[model samples]
Target: MRALCWTGVNETSVETVDDPKILNDPDVIVKVRLTTTCGSDLHLLGGYIPTMRAGDVLGHEFMGEVVEVGSAVQKHQVGDRVVVCSFIACGQCWYCSQELYSLCDNGNPNPALTETMWGSAIGGCFAYSHALGGFAGSHAEYIRVPYADHGAFPIPDGVSDLSALFASDAAPTGWTGADLAGITPGDTVAVWGAGGVGQMAARAAMLLGAEQVIVIDRLPERLEQAHQHIGAETLDYTKDSVVAELKERTGGRGPDVCIEAVGMEAHGTGPQYLYDQIKQQLRLQSDRPTALREAIYACRKGGSLFALGVFGGLVDKFPFGAIMNKGMTVRGAQQHGHRYIPRILQHLADGELSTEHLATHVMPLEEGPRAYQMFKDKKDGCVRAVFQPNGASSTSY
Candidate 1:
């Protein structure tokens, strides 16, 4: 089996590895049909996320056909097409019952590893790191999906593979952010980062009844996508002050909801951003909260700010004052994909949601390294680089 393996900081390669076998009663082996790069993968590639080791498989967003299923996996069987959630969950757990699959108590096998950093383990994620469960990711020929009944959702008859691909991660993540923020009718929503998740968040805001949806990013292509596909008013953060423009657009009121989809690797245009960058590089801070800080500053009084971005640890100089003085609510979570994948699939089937545009580059799994390079550099408007393990025949769209 050929898979992308993380070897060191800023380095990865295709390595032929041993094929996965069913390890748990609820587990299933999936011949990966399609997988894609995520912005969060940049955290792993840049060596920001801790506990990643040499030869760790690296990818979380994927969908595939079941090649084998374990004894207890009754709902899924060989040849079943499914999109597995990024976060592993046991449906019977307390948190899972509450639809909080990302916080499932029974998911992480190595609780002590995350307990050291986060005080408690959240959930096991495919190919994130040992701290997050160390499950092999889907950027390979095949991947082992555990808790199949709980996390794997079958793609509907008419949903394209490209649409189902994002249900595995980005769409659910954006939906989670919007769902948690409690968007109401006529509310004004602003999303930072026009990447895959950000674009999805913008679209979700519209679907959730936000009267005005604004997407912020420096990338013109992404902003154009937001404008054309998601029907969002786009802002170029580099050209205009995000806070000022958002306030002006809202007629002196900031956005009612602000979503931060840009995580620890946020780039900045000023000294504060530069300071964060330097400190982060020196191991002085665990993340760059540039987008988060802006979200807080740009959120209206009594508004909500939701973080869908992946922040590894503590940030320096966060505006606790802004959150306090403005009476704002702040919340964040890893995507509880199990809770949202089904609904998103329906939206895809109904033509209410379109994520096919995000798949800007599609290639065979053998070009994994090059695809990642283009994705990382954001080259040629590469929003999401997708890989087809079985080549073109595996693609349904």
Candidate 2:
């Protein structure tokens, strides 16, 4: 099998790899149909996230057909179309029982690394890093899905493959932020970064009945998509004062909820951004929290803030003072897609969610390297470069 592999820092290639087989009684083999590059993949590509070895397969968000089933996998069988969650979880853990699927105790098999780094390990994600179980990613023709009954959801009949693909990660991630950040009806919400996650977060806020939802970014193309597809207001941070404009738009109160979807590689104007970049490159900090800081400062006092972005490790100049003085609620988590994917799929089936527009570039598995370059550079207005590992046709299923 040919799969996309992370060759080195800022490098990727298509390489021949062994095909996956069912490894456990609870596992199944999925023939990937569509898999897409995610912003979080940039962290691994740039060497920000440690433990990513050369030749590690790269991808997580995907939808596919079940090719082979395991003995214990009852919910699915051969030929079933399913979208697997990015996070791998075992259904019987205490965390899974509590609906915190991403924090499932049995998820990450290689837990010592992350346990040492963050005190405790969270969950495993496909091809995220060695620290997250080292599972082969979905950027290939076949992927082994562990805990198939818990981690994969059936795509509803009316939802297209393109629409269901995002339910694997991006959309559920947005729902995680909005649902956990305590979004209330008639509240004003602001999301930083107009990428797929940010746009999805804005859409989630709107569906949650937020009176006003705003998405901020420097890209004209993403902002336009936010307006047209997500039906949210957009702000070009490069052209206007984000904090001031947000305050003005929200009647001097600022946004009731502020979500930061731009993670480690956040780009911004000013000395702070340069400082972050230099520090990150110098190995002084593992992440750039430029948009996160802005989101905190932009949220109204007593408002809620959610960090939906992926951050690997420590960051400098975190504003603990503002959080203390403003009485703000701050929360962050990986997407617990198992808890939300069913509803998201229903939304897609009902024609209430729009995700196909996020797939700006669709190519074959052979174009994996070029696709990652374009996606990482944000070139040609590429939001997400979708890879059809098995081919573009869905008729085979």
TM-score of 2: 0.99
lDDT tens per residue, model 2, 238-272: 99999999999988989999999999899999999
Residue 250 shift from truth in candidate 2, angstroms: 1.0
C-alpha lDDT (0 to 100) for residue 340 of candidate 2: 93
Q: Write the per-residue lDDT of candidate 1 for residues 1-397, one digit (tens) a residue.
A: 9999999998989999889998989999999989999999989999998889999988999999999999999899899889989999998988999999999999988789778788878999999999889899999999999999999999999888888999999999999999899999899999999999998888888999999999999988999999998999999988999999999999998999999999998987999999999999999998999999999999999999998999999899999999999999999999988888999999998999989999999898888888888999989999999988777653469
* Predicted structure with the largest lDDT when compared to the true one: 2
- What residue runs in model 1 are displaced by over 4 Å at the alpha carbon? none
Local error of candidate 1 at residue 394 (angstroms): 5.8
Locate the minimum summed-lDDT window of 10 residues in model 2. Answer: 388-397
